[model samples]
Target: MPKVRIVDIEDRRFRVFSSPTVPGGREFVLVHGIGISHRLFSRLHRVLSAKHTVHTLDLPGFGGMPRPDSDPDIADMARDLAEVLERLGIGPVVAVGDSMGTQWVVELGAQRPDLVTHVVAIGPVADARHRTLFAQAAALGLDSLREPPSANARVLVEYARCGPRWYGRQVRHMIDYPLEQRAAELVPPLLVMRGGRDPIAGPEWSRAVARCAPRSRFVEVPGQPHLVQHTAPRPVAEAIEWFLAEVPQ
Candidate 1:
């Protein structure tokens, strides 16, 4: 896992993780949620890395990197990701995102359709029905109750490392991102997935995302929680693989 430094136009350096690409194999890029880095997707990455080229990106300010002088919104972060992939010469890869990371991928797909072949959003955030901060917090709390102790412990550590002040700022951007509206503009295929037991991203919200998009699908990983990628990597990976094979041309 080599760390690739991506310097944005503002000269902010973002360290991203990259895996070696296999000849004639599918390409995948995994984006993690706010307050956590690529570490959360370690299990999922390993499962996919066996057969596909997987790149795990750690946006600036997360995963031990220095925070930018100013916070960047979802669109800005999406452009940074596109620039990084462009510099690396990677093209039209499947982008998988978790939680708030989903918003970034949606923005990326809408902004750079040429760079992304498809997008998979797992446990996406800011459900329209529960748009308020308090409602989102309540849903997260409910999901936390369903998640395993180990998963909760990991999140606690990651959140502490992220620091309350910085994490709060990022959450504001996340909750404010208009995911459904942006989803409508995505040219690439979109797949919105939610864990059966995930309260953060319910079935209704996931389906709404699919409905808004021109080419999209919605799936559910049963008996999984908010951290399905960590707890149910096989199922999540299988779903993504199936979607990739069925993506519209």
Candidate 2:
């Protein structure tokens, strides 16, 4: 079993689940969305770790980590992640993010392109169609109808652990982040993915995000919901592998 390692970055600390690096294999870093931890990517980690080194991160205030004095915005989180990667001496890895995780990945790609070779954002969040809290909630409610029971159970558990106050603060930061603008600044090869039936990140939003980056492609997992990475880990992993193969190292 992979154990958690605490990494200090200035005043803040992060909990990391790191696997040993494989010889001649690429390093992959997984980032989870708001109010959730690396647990969300356990299946994906298991699949990828077979052939490559995988590092799943639990940013501050999530995954049982102590909350900071105030909630850090998406860019703040990205900056801290960039610093963490630099201190860890891992570079040129494919950074994979899900939901609100996309904002962190995009900002990192823009801020520290040297650290990330390729980017994969699954079910990226805050579609322009639903900008406000109510609208986003509505979309989430609609999509919840399509998600699997296991996914719902896991989400509930994670949310309860996150608590209402912290989760609400994180949501505000997530929805307020200028994802598209920062995505356009990404220097790494970017791949945008979402579930075909995902109400939050629908076709239009996914296409728009893809267009933000010059070298980007949009792919969808058919018949899946917002938590497609969990529901269809194989396909998502396959897509990421294909993208990694195509991207120049």
Candidate 3:
């Protein structure tokens, strides 16, 4: 089991689940999307931990972490993430995020280039074409239908923990974040990935997100849904490995 630790940042708190380090192995950080927690990345954490150190984060206001007095935008969450990494003394890591988590990691890479060596966006969100709250909600609804039972159950449980009030507060930030613009500004190599069948981060949007980055590659995992990382951990892990191999470490 990964060691779980609580890191407090002012009025907010974060939960970090860390796997034992492997000597000479590269570090990897996993960030979950909106209304979810580190539990969503459990499978991916298991796979990555086999070869490298893995840290899964439950940012403030989600994953049973204490919610701040007020809502934070994407950049605020990114700063909190950076602080956790700095406090943990882990840096220059391959930062991987799913859905809105992509925005957080992208902002992290843009704000603290020294902390992240690479940014992997799995099923990135806020498709340039459908940036409205209703459009994103529809996509998420459709994705729920496509996800496997286990994945849906996990998401439901996490959502219940997050509560509708908090989820509502965060969705606005997720919808408003300009991920493509941030990706273009990121100094680290970017890997944009999506499930071939994902409705939220469709093929064109994923490609566009990748194209925004000077150094980026796009990969599609076939027959998977939005939460591809959770449902198809091995394939996602393989795709990340391929990206890492191609990227100049």
Winning candidate number (TM-score): 3
Models 1 onward score TM values of: 0.94, 0.96, 0.98
Tell me each candidate's RMSD, in Å, in order: 1.6, 1.3, 0.9
Give residue 58's error in model 2 in angstroms.
Answer: 0.9
Candidate 1 local accuracy as lDDT? 0.86
lDDT score for residue 191 of model 2? 96
Would you list the C-alpha lDDT of every candidate in the order shown? Answer: 0.86, 0.86, 0.92
Worst 10 residues of 2 by lDDT: 3-12
Which parts of model 2 have CA positions greater than 4 angstroms off? none
- Return the candidate ranking by TM-score, descending: 3, 2, 1
lDDT of 2 by residue, 119-226 (tens): 999988889988898998899889879999888778888878878888888899888888888888888989999999999998998999999887888889999998
The residue pairs in collision within model 3 are: none
Q: Put the candidates in lDDT order, highest first.
A: 3, 2, 1
Q: Give me the overall lDDT of model 3.
A: 0.92
Instruction: Please provide, for model 3 over 132-231, each residue's C-alpha lDDT reduced to its tens digit, 9 standing for 90 to 100.
Output: 8888888889999999998899898989988988888999998888898999998999999999899999898899999999899999999999999988
lDDT of 1 by residue, 116-208 (tens): 999899988888767787897898889889988978888888888878777888899988898999999999999999889988888888898
